[model samples]
Target chain A: MSEVTAPMAGKVIDVKVNVGDTVSEDDELIILEAMKMEMPLVAPTSGTVKEIKCKKGDSVGADDVLVVIE
Target chain B: MLDMVMTTGVVHLTVGNLIMWLIAFFFIYLAITKNYEPLLLVPIGFGILIVNLPLTYLMQEGEGLLWKFYHYGLEWEVIPPLIFLGLGALTDFGPMIANPKTLILGAGAQFGVYVAFFGALILGFKIPEACSIGIIGGADGPTTIFTTVHLAPHLLGATAVAAYSYMSLVPIIQPPIMRLLTTEKERKIKMRQLRPVSKKEKILFPLVTVMVICLIVPASAPLMAMFMLGNLFKECGVVKRLSDAASNELMNIVTILLGISVGATMSAEHFLKPEVILVFIMGLIAFAFSTAAGILLAKFMNLFFKEKINPLIGSAGVSAVPMAARVSQVVGSKADPKNYLLMHAMGPNVAGVIGTVVAAGVFIALAG
Candidate 1:
C-alpha cells in the first residue's frame, strides 16, 4: 500500500473516493479548505484505494495520511 | 431676519455649484443603474452631492466631518495601506508561484506608468504631479491613492476617480488593444496546466516578499508590510480572525471613509482645473499603453519560449485583478472556447498588483 498524505493543514471538505475505488494519476481525491479557498488534493499515482483515512470535516495537518492506495 | 437666514442657501448658489451637482448626479446614476464600482462610486456620488450643496459646512476648512476624515484617512496616508491589507486577504498567489515567468508580464504592464509620467511632464505638470498621474496605469485604486497622497495630494481626487473609472471600464478599453496586438492563432494557443503550489510555499511567500521588498524600497514598506501581513494572516491559518476581520469589516469601514473623503476633495476650486482634465486624459492613455505593452512583451517572449503562451493573458498584467484576467478569458474564448486561460491569466493578473506597488515604490524613492 502507498500513502497519500495531506499536503496542507486544512479541513477535509469532501472525500471523492471510497475504499476499493480505482483511481488514475492526478485524479482529484479530496477537497481541502484553507486560506478561505478550496483546494483539491489529487492522486500522485494510479492505484486502487485500499483505505480511506480522512473524511469530510476531519482537520488534517501536513504529511498526515489521508488515503492508502495499492 | 428669519426668512433671510432660511434663504441663505439660494443666495449663495452659483453656476459652479449647479455644474458640480449635475456631475454628482451622473456619478450616482452610474453607480445605481450601471453598477460601475458602486462600492466606491455610490459613496463618492453621495459625498459629492453633500459637499456641493450651497452654503453647506460639510467641506468647510477644519470644521467639516468629511474634511476631517480626508485629513485623517488620506492626508495622513492611513487608509490606502489599510485597504491593501484587505486586498492581501482576498488575493491568492498560487498562480504566480506555479508560473514564475508570468511576473515579466506584470513588469511589462508598468510601461504605461512611465509613458504617462513623461506625457504629464511634457504637458507641463510638475514632477510630483506627473508621478501621481502616471500611477493610474497601475489600475489599482488604493495604490493610486497612496501615491497621490504622498506625491501630490492636490491631485488626489481627480486621480482616484480616474483610476476607479477606468478600472470599471477595463472590459471596454482592453479588448480592442488586445485584438490589435495578436493574431487569432496566438490568442488560441493553449498553455500547459500549472503545477499545484505547496502549502509551505504559500506560507513562506509573504514573509520572504516583505523582507526582500522592504529592504530594497523602504518607502513601500507601509503599504507592502500591511499587505504581506494580511496575506500571512490568511496563509498561516493560525490567525483566521485577523484575516476575516481584514477582509470584511475593516475593508468595508476603510472603503467608506476613503470614498467619501476622496469625493469631498472634489470642490469646484480643487477639481475644475485644466490640469484635472489632463489627468483624466493621461489616465486613459496609461491604461491603453499598458495593455499594448503587456501584449507586445508576450509576443516578444514567444520568440524564445518553447511552449507558446497565449498573448491575450498578457493584457491582464494591468492589475485590474480578476477583471483584467476575465477579459483575457473572454477574448480567448472568442478565438477558441476549448482554451481555458483564466487560471493561466491569473498568474500575471496577481503579479500585476505586486508590480504596480513596486513601481509606485520606485517613484516614491525618486520623487517623493
Candidate 2:
C-alpha cells in the first residue's frame, strides 16, 4: 500500500473517491484549498482505493497523508 | 508676568481644535481596537492630534517637523515612487503573466475614476481638484497621493485619507456589489489552474512593462520605472540584498514618514469644510462603481471566450492588492465552498495596480 500526501497546507474541500473504489493514475481524488486556490490531488498510480484519511472541511498540513491506495 | 503666562498655546485652543482631536482619536481607536490599517492610521492619527494642538508648528511652512517630511517626501514626489519600489519587490507577477487577459480587467476597473471625475466637475470642482479627488477611486493610496501632489496639492490630505480608508474597507464594500452584479452560477464557475510561469518570463515582464508604459505615458516614469526596477531586483536572482532592503527596511521607513506627513496635512482649517465631506462621499461612490464595472466587464468577456471566466474575480481589479483579491475569494467561496478564486483573482488584482498607475500618468500628463 502507498499513501498519498497533501502537497501543501490547506483545507480539504472535497473528497472525490471512496474507499474500495478503483482509480486510474492522475484521476482527481481530492480537492485541497490553500492560498485561496483549489488544487486537485490526483491518484499517483492506478489501484483500488484503500482508505481516505481526510474528509470535507478537514484542515491539513503539508505532507499529511490524505489517502492510501493499494 | 500675567500676560506672558496667558500667551501659552492652551489659551489659543478653539472648539475647532477639540473637534479635530476627537477625529484624530477616532482614527486611533479604529487602528488599535478595531484592527483597521493600524500601521497607517496610528501614525496618521497621532500626526493629526499633534498638528492641531493650537500652535505646535508641526506643519509650519519651512521649519515644522512634518512640513519638512511632507515637502521633501511628498512635494518632491519621492515617497510614493519609493513605496512603488517596495510594492514591486513584494509582488508576484507570475499569475498576471500566466493570464494576460486579466490586464484588460485591470484597465476596465478605471471606469470609476473617470465617472468620479465628471461627477466632481458637475459638483463645481475645478479640473485639477477634480482629478485629484477622482483618483481616490483607484483604491491605491500612493497613486492617489502622487496624482494629488501633481494636480491639486491643497486636496492632498482628504484625497489620500479617502484612498487609504476606502482601501481598508474593500472587504465590506466589495461583497454587496459583487453579489449584486454576478449570479450564483457565475460565482461558482471554476477557472482552469494558472500555468506555471518561467523565470525568464518573470524577468522579462518588468523590462517590457517599463519600456511600453513609459514610452506611452512618459509622465509615469518616476513610479513605473522604480516599480519595474524593484520587480527586476526580485526576479533576477542576483540582487537578493537589494530586493530585501527595498521591500522591507526602506519600505517601512518611508511608510512612517508618509503616514504622518499625510496626516499633518489634515489640519482643521483645511479638513473642516463642506467640500471635504463631498470628497469622502465621492470616494465611496468611486469604489462601488469600480467594483461593479470590473464584474460587468468579466461577464461581458464570458460571452466570447470558450473557457468561461468567473465574474467574481473581476471585482479584485480595484488594486487594493491582497485585500481586494481576498474579498473575491471570500465572496466566491460563499457561493460554493469548494470554489477557490483567490489565485485567479490575483491576476486582475495585480493588473489593477498597473492600470491605476497608467491612469495616474494620464491625469498628470493632462492636468500637470
Candidate 3:
C-alpha cells in the first residue's frame, strides 16, 4: 500500500478520490489549504485507492497520511 | 485655580484634538478587535492619542521621546532599511528563483504607481507629493515611508498609514478586482508544478539580484543592500544566529519604534487636511489600478506561452507579501477547488517587493 501524505500543514479542502477509485501517478487526490493557499496533493503511484483518511475541511499536518493506495 | 487649570493640557485641547482622539480610538479598536495589522496599529493608535494631547512634549523636537524616534530612526533613513533586512531574512525566494518570468509581473504591478503619480498631479499635487502618494499602490509600507521621506517628508504620515492600511485590506480589496479583471476560465487554469530549486541557486539569488538591481538603481542600495544581506545570512547556513536576530529580535525592536514614531507624526495640525483626505482617496485608486494591471498583464502573457498561467495569481504582484498571494490563492481556488496556486502566486508576490523598491529608487532619483 502506498500512503499519500500532506507536504505541508493545512486544512483539507477537497478529497477527489474514494476507496476503490483507481488513480495514476501524479493524479491530484486531495486539496489542502495552507498559508491561505490551496495545495493539491497528488498520488505517488498508479494504484487503486485503498483508504480515504481525510475529508473536506479536515486540518492536517505535514507528512500526515491523507490517503492510502494499494 | 484658574491659572493652574490653564497650565493643564486640557485648557489647550481643541475640537481638532478631540477629533484626532476619536480617530486614534477607531484605530485601536480595529487593531484589537478586528485584528488589522495590530502590531502596527496599536502602537500607532497610541502614538496618535498621546501626540494629540496638547503640551505633552512627546513630539517636541530634540527633547521628546517619539520625536527622537522619528528623527534618528526615520529622518536619518535608518528604520525602513532595517525593516527590509528583517523582511529579507523572513522571505523565501525559492518560488521566484524557480520562475523568473514572475519578475515581470512584479514590474507590471508598478503600473499603478505611475498611474497614481499622474492622477495626483492632475489633482494639483506637486511632483514630490504626487510621487509619495503614487507609491502607496505598491502596498509596501517600508518602501512608501522610505520614498516619502526622501521625496516629500511632509506627507510621510499620511502615505505610511495609507500603505499599511491598504496592505491589511489586501484580502478585501484584491478579490473584487481579481474577479472583475479575470474570466472564470482564466481563473481555473492550472499551472504546472514548480521544479525543486537547488541550494546553490537559492544562495546565488540574493547576490545576483542585489548586483543587478542596485547597479541599475543606485539609490535603492540603502534598503536593497541590507535586504540582500539579510537574505544571504539566512541562505548561507553559516550564520543562523545572525539570521535569527535580523528576522526576530531586531525586527521587533525597530517595528515598535517605527510604528510609534510614524503614528506621532500625525498630529492634528499635520493630519486633518483636505489634502490628507485626497491622499487616502488616491491611495485606494493606486491599489485598485495595480491589482488590475497585474491580472491584465498575466492575461496578456498567456497569449504566447504554451504553458498557460492562471491570471488570478497575477494580482499577487502588488507585494503585500503573503497576503496578496493568499488573495490569489483564495480567489483561484474559488474557481476550481482542485487548483493550488499559492506557491505559484508567491513568485510574483516576492518579485513585487523588488519591483516596488526599484520603483521607489527611480522616484527618488528623479524627484528627491
TM-score: which candidate is best? 3
Q: B228-331, model 2: which lDDT tens digit per residue?
A: 99999999999999999999999999999999999899898988889999999888888888999999999999999999999998999999998998899889
**What is the RMSD, in Å, between candidate 3 and the native fold over all Cα?**
4.0
Misplaced by over 4 Å in model 1 are: A1-70
Ranking by TM-score: 3, 2, 1
Higher TM-score: candidate 2 or 3?
3
Candidate numbers, best DockQ first, in rank order: 3, 2, 1
TM-score of chain A of each: 0.94, 0.97, 0.95
Residues B1-368, model 3: lDDT tens digits: 99999889998998999999998999999999999999999999999999999999998999999999999999999999999999999898988888888998988998999999999999999999999999999999999999998988889889999999999999999998898888899998988877778889989999999999999999999999989999999998999999999999999999999999999999999999999999999999999999999999999999988889899888999999999998887798778755668888999999999999999999999998
Q: How many residue pairs clash in each candidate?
A: 0, 0, 0
Which numbered prediction scores highest in lDDT against the true structure?
Answer: 3
Model 3 stretches with alpha carbons more than 4 Å out:
A1-33, A36-66
Where in model 2 is the C-alpha error above 4 Å? A1-70
| Worst 10-residue lDDT window, candidate 2 chain B | B332-341
